[model samples]
Target: MTFIAGWLPSDLNNPSNDNIAGPDSVAIKGPTGGFLVPAGATVSNIGFHSKNAVPAKFSIYAIDFTLLAETGGATTGGAGDELFPLLTDWTPQVDTYVYVAALTSSYLTGIGGDANLRFMPYASRVYEDGFPNPFVQAGTANTPKQALWLDGTLAASGPSIPEADDITDESQPVTFTLSGNENAPTGITINGEVGSNLIFVSENTGAGTETYSYEPPLIADDDTTDLVVSVDGATAATVIAYTNSYDRDQLTHPATEAEYSENSLSYPNAYATTQPYEWKVVTDANASVVTINWNALEADDGFHKDVASYATPVANGSTTVTLGVFVPETGQAYQFDRTITVSDGSVVVTGEGLWCELFRDPTEELFTELFR
Candidate 1:
């Protein structure tokens, strides 16, 4: 988050506690910080905090100052000061806790005002369930982290709790690109929270372009780009803000080898790949019943019976799939039956025993030997 401060035209050369008015002490919810007020602005009063989840009130003030115009016979006020534009004093209603007082101008660099431009000290409110506020009591050692408990309530235990979202001003989205090295593989896409995708297309023999698109369109004052990147099955990469684009600075991310490999089968002793095996299956729109037929083959393994029947089929597509089975003493795979539902748009497919599978000998003896 970027920082913005109020400006005024007071010379701080003479440290006089008697000159200022209203609450002299200021508290900030974020981090302790300081800023300078441009000339001519007066220090009025600063306030913070409110009952709303988003505090309705926040402000700051300054004192005795002169607004000197950019063009003037420079008035020398003191040893540590130079002359600037001067103006009269006035007060304006606060808006969204952020207030600015300066000569009206499209640009902020050059302007002067007499009234105090309120500075909203950073403020935040965190509410916990059951608990009245954010602070935790001293005796609650076993309390779940991030969990809220009433002051005198019984200690509760259950699932781990999550903290509330941090409140902050929404940020704007930034457009950026990434250039990959010539040796890098193409077709990479990075995703951002805003539903933007950075696609890497081989534009030339050596480089590609990464573009960003909003998922749900962005709104004004909203943080536009919370960058997220996806590679070939590895954990996604997080891109930094302000860094819109990066030249492939050496290979930091790469595709997984499993994503690039192929599966193969070979004969037992013939040392050749030749097969006339035929496999067939059938099912309704709702995968209620499924049957498979593998044409008879020379039975090398005791499981040459090739009519594979799946009471149920694997519904979800996964690069790696596993079915969990428990054997009391000797661990072994077992079959189970369950109904499954499939949906695409308005169409619905429902079938019973859709996931039942019998794990017998491998279809190929060499394939069976590899696992043993």
Candidate 2:
């Protein structure tokens, strides 16, 4: 086990001073040279201490490896074997203490051995010294500073959280788009746990707004979530709504009935009318049902009254009547009389049936009967 504790100095200590000890220097002690750490070892209190006024603040830095040094080496031969380096006219300071404890398992792992070993202590400013020095050098009276040899695994770095303005008003919906400095996530998810629920509508897919319409909207540190919207392994847009709102009118409409006919007078088709009449109408939603309304009715025609009086003929049981005017199939049917009476310079028919049939080229007898 290895424990490294040190105080961060305000700046580099004065050179040529072996008795001077400041806060910025760090002391690292662990398995080095022949003194290998035991297999089952635990290291704690390994953190950075700042020499700030009032109260010193320390933060624990979780690292996988520790530093060690080798001493008493020559510039050409033993100098290269030492773990630490020696600076020009620099002296090592005291008051820096680091602890190391090896677990029983460490011995089983091959790090610990029964042979006696000797290890040297080293100090270096992490920021200036660049850790994990490849060369194992020795320290001198003038240049006693050595490289910090830290060994262990480092924590994996994770993606950063997005930052934006915080919405305080519950009624206001927060809308945002997902973006990445380089690559966007494969997919994004949004949990709508907010007041009265919120809706997100997408015009691209008619997948109207997803609603988070609960009593209290779900609070999230960040609105954007990574999600993949691509299909068939193709690229797609990353634009999505975190919170949305839409009008109710855009989703619903009133039911309506339209004009229609069964025989030759079927809907969307107009057949010749034998008598004076108005158009009939039918209406429906998603389907066409009988939709009779005042809007569907056509204006009344004077010729219709005359045709209405002609009862179903006793002989053929049907009478063919011609309409004096064009009548749409959307209103009441009318008829002109079989017995017509001339009045005011025009032959005025007594009556006509509403929505009645019209006569083709009329015969002499039919004309006489209609004119009479």
Candidate 3:
């Protein structure tokens, strides 16, 4: 989801063409829209596509006109979907600039290859699904958006979340911390697919540390991060690909006003605070029937009595029985059953309903709330 071009690249792609390739033409102009491999990342799957009947000069070069790589001779007719993977050991340091250029046919002698032979970033490597031979319809193919791949596993760590796990939850806010190998990512997208509008920059606090804070309301959404640095205006190298998942929807409200305030980054009201009630169950190992004790001096609005039930099958060996709660009125307050009781059926193995507020602690309203 980080736009690794796993599914689609960020290059100029318009998959529609009425004209076909013949002898030769200078179609693609990489020198204008150039790209560079960043300092700490390894980029791959860089190739080009073609539909030609003759050979061509498809090559990448450094800014100094140094030839870095070149694909083999051209095929018969440049059929659509004919991908050519370049033979490249392309590894650039902090700032290595490169461009792709090509020449097709003899009449176009001295003229570079057709720049319009859209392709993956590299040379002829074809991957087609449910399509005719040569992938393209001989004459119909879109302006190719180069295929892109980045292996961040090897790249040194960049600014990262200190807590590393921030699932969407109403009760708990998320604090993202980045330290070590830190750099300001050019851009970030968070659940942008689902229209969850929450974007902010991390504060760069000298000493290789930066931080970003999201109030619970904002943090309680999707859980994915796509960070990237610009390669060219049209392409980029992924900086950090991260995802944090926790019991964002788990029930068991905060214990105190301070706790609620800390998790939500705001003051606590009656609904946000934990309820003064108990729904507990105990069972022995491998118990068939589990009994739950329910006593509510005052039922909190955030808890739904009907939906709170034993949400697991017969107790297995040291199994956990969950107390599931559903508050449909205010889904923001809806919580999955985080409270679990270890049960065999005869006695409760663990307490079924106790939530620990595990979020960044908040200080006073004047400082913390305003910051969020």
Candidate 4:
């Protein structure tokens, strides 16, 4: 949010009104120009100044001459300035003409009968052509004056996120786009977790479109998460995304031959020697139940029938086994194949034995056996 102070002519003074004879009689004065507030801008307060240290009441009107806001009352203290804050914030939808009327006080006669007050509207952001004049005074009596000007400190608007939609894929990382409108956001979070990979697509004077990528943890199907954007430690926008239904295609098995090749059991004693087989299943979705089926292999002792760690007996010849994996979260079953080969002690016993045998028997027959 931006802070715009004194957004109207603060130097303009109300002329003396002798018609306001007493405290009951009021002389209403307005400007001859108006200001245009930007879309989404909010008017927080209006400022008043008295050149003659006189007390007065102010009222703000819209371009249609409708009453929008007003001040209870304000008096120029020793500093000759006071702020009349609104009870509720006001946001104009279209071009608004902020008209301020200074109702005379009993001291009007004491202060040379001149109200001599200046009024300025304070708002968040101003449009490019919001203020048309630097100095504006009252035109006609109670005809809804249009004069406007701005003073005091000026600031840029806050950051914003315009897109708020659900994501389709939970397995893939998501990127959220945000607009740093004049002021860059200090931080961003997803599901209360800090986001990573913050990249700015373009930056110009602290304003640009930035992207934050986040890889969600394993979540259950149809679950939702929130991506919140914050500025100055205040939450500005929140985007919700739901995980899609679990699919069998989303699960992957990253098995390698090296994992099983090093655990091959010796022949003849293959039943006594068990080969450790642990094939992990990787997925971005939660799994309530997981089961592994070791086809054509003798299973050993383990939890859940060796779903995570499988110790199986191997034979002499090479055999292919299809492992069936089931996930209760998806209610689906998947399969993967792995081939195991056991040494019969014909050429070599182990990896060290094979290298030792190669050094002793460096012939074409040994070379062919090694390659085969």
Best by TM-score: 4
Query: Model 4, range 201-281, lDDT digits (tens) per residue?
Result: 443323335555555433333345666766655566665766543322212221222222233321111111122222222
The regions of model 2 sitting more than 4 angstroms off are 1-137, 141-155, 162-182, 192-372
Tens-digit lDDT track of model 2 for 258-295 = 22211111111122333333221221111121111222
Please give the CA lDDT of all the candidate structures. 0.22, 0.24, 0.34, 0.39
| Clash totals in order | 34, 97, 50, 9
Q: In candidate 1, what residue range of length 10 has the lowest lDDT sum?
A: 144-153
lDDT of 3 by residue, 129-227 (tens): 311122221222332333322222123434333333344443344444444433333333333322122334565544344554443332223334443
Tens-digit lDDT track for model 1 on 200-277?
332322223333322222211122333433333232233332221111111111122222111201111111112222
Candidate ordering by lDDT (highest first): 4, 3, 2, 1
Q: Pick the winner on TM-score between candidates 2 and 4.
A: 4
Model 1 Cα shift for residue 246 (angstroms) = 33
Task: Give me the runs in candidate 3 sitting further than 4 Å from their true place.
Answer: 1-32, 41-46, 106-180, 183-372
Point out the higher-scoring one by TM-score: 1 or 3: 3
Best by lDDT: 4
